[model samples]
Target chain A: MHYFDCCDFTIASEIAWPVSFPASREPEVEIRYRNLPTDLGEGGERGFRFHAKPNELLICVDGVARYLIRGGKEIWIEPFPHADEDSIVAFLQSSVLGVLLLQRRFLVLNGGVFNVDGEGIALVGCSRAGKSTLAAAFQRIGASLFSDELCAIKQDSSGRMMAWPVLPALSLWENTLIQQGGDVTKLRPIRPSIRKYLVPTHAKSLSPVPLTQVVELKDYHGDLLWKTVDVKEAITLVLGNTYRHRFLIGMALKDAHFLQSTALIQQSRFYIAQRHLTVTSEDAFFHFVRTNLAL
Target chain B: MKSIVWLASYPKSGNTWLRIFLENLFFATDEPCDINNLRSSFMSCSLDLFDHECGWDVSLLSHDEIDRLRPEIYTYIDSQWENVKYFKTHCAYSFTGSGEAFFPDEATKAAIYLIRNPLDVCISYAHHRGYSDYDRIIAEMADAASCLCSDTDQPFWQARQKILSWSLNVESWLSVEGFPVLFLRYEDMKNNPYEAFSRVAAHLGVNKSELEIRQAIKNSSFEELQKQESLNSFKEKPSRSKKFFRSGQNGMGYAMLSRSQVASIIANHGQIMAQFGYL
Candidate 1:
């Protein structure tokens, strides 16, 4: 069991560290998190809590607390139950690094992100709704990519809003990968139903860009249409498309910070994009995004 | 003797409309139609509730397990809701290992089945749920229709199939001896509300004056249901963000389907579709 201590908590667990997180000694803000025990059918429940100076984020499962540490860059989770060494390394590179890149505190769901730009544009839609598809498009057209899937949004000491990268790579479908001339060998097998690959974003493209517009891609009858919607509609749409894990909704409802952050997100611009009914290739979608969106 | 009424249909095939018609006619309330209330008031049974009560673990269950448990679960459900129940189901006509029966053994209070042209069903399902291709959707419908006819337990391939199987299940229940059965076509419901709702009322053994039935029809109209604030809100998680009520027009599917695909659906499920005057 590995023991970690910070502030008022300590955690020990049998699950080995599959990946190493780069340690930080400089103390800016300190937060503590400990894993909790669980009885869920899948095995034991694993959970953690975070305590900052004035605020605390507690996540407990079955009943045991595991790892408690003061805040550093960000909390990195290396997808647990790694069977082999290479998988651990991949987990560290893909998942742990992904979390560190996030400049602000944020939630990750189904490995996707619903980020609102500074200008109030919220990109919201379902899985395979071309969020990464459009993000790749923006990248190709010279728009700095903040995050491919998850992003952190926090208020600085000056009370100014900022967005940060969460994941270093964007997942692309086979069709999108082929369109962007991506290396298929780097692609990881996600499932039998669909093909998925991770494409690394350029380090230069890592900086936070002001969010100006929100676009939602919907598949309709063979036609591309775009319409701007007000904030209320955007909020409803974004909430609908959010990484909707069951616990996430409960968390969003109870946490004031989460609610405030989401409310801030609501103030941005929103659009509902009905993508082309039949596109011969991903280029068609990118072209449509380029021609229509200001980005 | 307890009576169980099943309100079954292929998805988006006017099941809601029929429910509205029945609600307005039976409740005799001037208050606008509220689908959420209507669903809860009628004692509707869905998978969500079933999973919570039985610890059935539906997500992990295999296809065979699902098939074996389907009928037994419904039987248990039928017994539980034996009092004035308006049960809702999406299962196609098939044996659930409760014997080779199409529906529960108890005497039905009423069985109303709503059907539409499979072509229309395919098109509507595709557009409404983001189905990418038509051929896959049609194959799915065909498989479901066959499953319904055979009374064999099989998982549905597509949403369209589920819808078609619902119609078939209703038809099978209607065919059972000594049960009050009513068949309402989506097209007829669209064109003539009075005639369709009157038939529904007669089947329900409710004696309403023509004026009352007319009021019920008017109250249950798609325009009115759409305007009602209650019907627009859903209590379930991952709330349906889009307008639940879309174009209630019949034959809107023709605009999207090729002539050949339309012909194929008709050819495969023509007898059942024609029975409900869908042709």
Candidate 2:
């Protein structure tokens, strides 16, 4: 089995994953390649090709594979015939990983996290909100990469909310790679057909760090604006940016998710940063973040 | 279980106008409802809604993959939503790669299709897109594979909608056998507001007094809409566009297009336009 350290947990997977950190402890989670049950019996929420129960979720992406995540401990994947390794691995890294984190009760954000100084500052937003772009920029200026795409956070025994490190790769579009002064043709695409290239980071944080700020990046045509969120709004922002938050209700973790968000908000700062799409420069964004956040 | 009534139309048609009218009709406020804050209708292709309802990141999925899941997402929303919901869409009535209807009958109560003359639509569409490329717009209108928000290079907040061509869009909605479709013309709505909107009220079973209809028509008039737009810019307006409610006239568009431009539209959509009295 291939062993890796992800989300502060030792993951022993039968399928090879592209994470950077090696497992330092015994396995807390096991990923096996097995045939998942076709049905979940009854009383579960369903999407087009998936079903979700309180502690189990069966996701079937046509032509890719079927993944059954159960009880936060194990993930069973059944790949479709003729499916490429990249496609299967892409789902495993994203949606399957996200479901597993939710089952483990971590406050996961669908964005990237980076270590600024010693604190974990998360940049959360919807898809294409420039989270990876900003994280890449932060890393260029000496910030250490903690996570990309999915950021998992949990309260440690010391009552400090910590951002758990995930895979040490950032998936960036072609334009973003060019803008970041990287050669796109040399980088491999995340999936064979997709234009997004997976750029591996050299400076990766393996251990969890104390979580401090969660900034929601917004793409707008107007001037750059920053809105300071109150604790109540901060809770909403955290929940809204939570990775696949719609699954919380289906998985019967709405109350638990809300509580986790409340606790996270109590310890961390939250802000909504609107970046002008056309006029604002990347340097301007970095300066704004550095100035307003005092990083 | 079906609670959604689609306000389906092509771009720059009377879809927004009908939405405004419905907003006024339902609330019956002293003053007109805010153009930016219309609660009557929601867009069908909102990416955030898709992401929330489908319990996944849509950006990770291919456009065809997203299309396959849209029916199920809409059904989920229909099951959860209590009241009758009106969703505005610029998508033509079409099926996914898996042969599933994009606007599934199981989740749809009915539909209101607002069709306009292609000649006028071309002019308004150019303005709405903040461009004056009439020839390009004309060509796009005749291309069967035309769509809205189809850009793949950049991230957009809305999902892609395949609207097809002018004739195909009209034909597709007209051929729907699963649910009732109240096909209204933009010209008729502008000319006979009472008769046109009364049909709208009847189709959706929104019973209103005669005075209510009159007041709603007055509140949703082109002048009132223009005035409201001038006061506070409409949120749906493209940033490059100067105004959203620009000259809600009929024949003015026909007069503006070149002789060849009008002939091209007639050649492309002659049959459909004639059927709708637009010719």
- Name the best candidate (by DockQ): 2
lDDT of 1: 0.50
Clashes of 2: 0
True contacts kept of 2: 0.11
Question: Model 2 clash pairs?
Answer: none
The weakest ten consecutive residues by lDDT in model 1 chain A span: A54-63
TM-score of chain B of each: 0.75, 0.97
**What docking class should model 1 receive?**
incorrect
Error of 2 at B232 (Å): 5.2
Interface RMSD of 1: 13.2
Model 1 per-residue lDDT tens digits across residues B146-214:
432121222121111233443455555556664666767788888887888788778767789998898
Compared with the true structure, what per-residue lDDT tens digits does model 1 show for residues A139-160? 6765555555443444544544
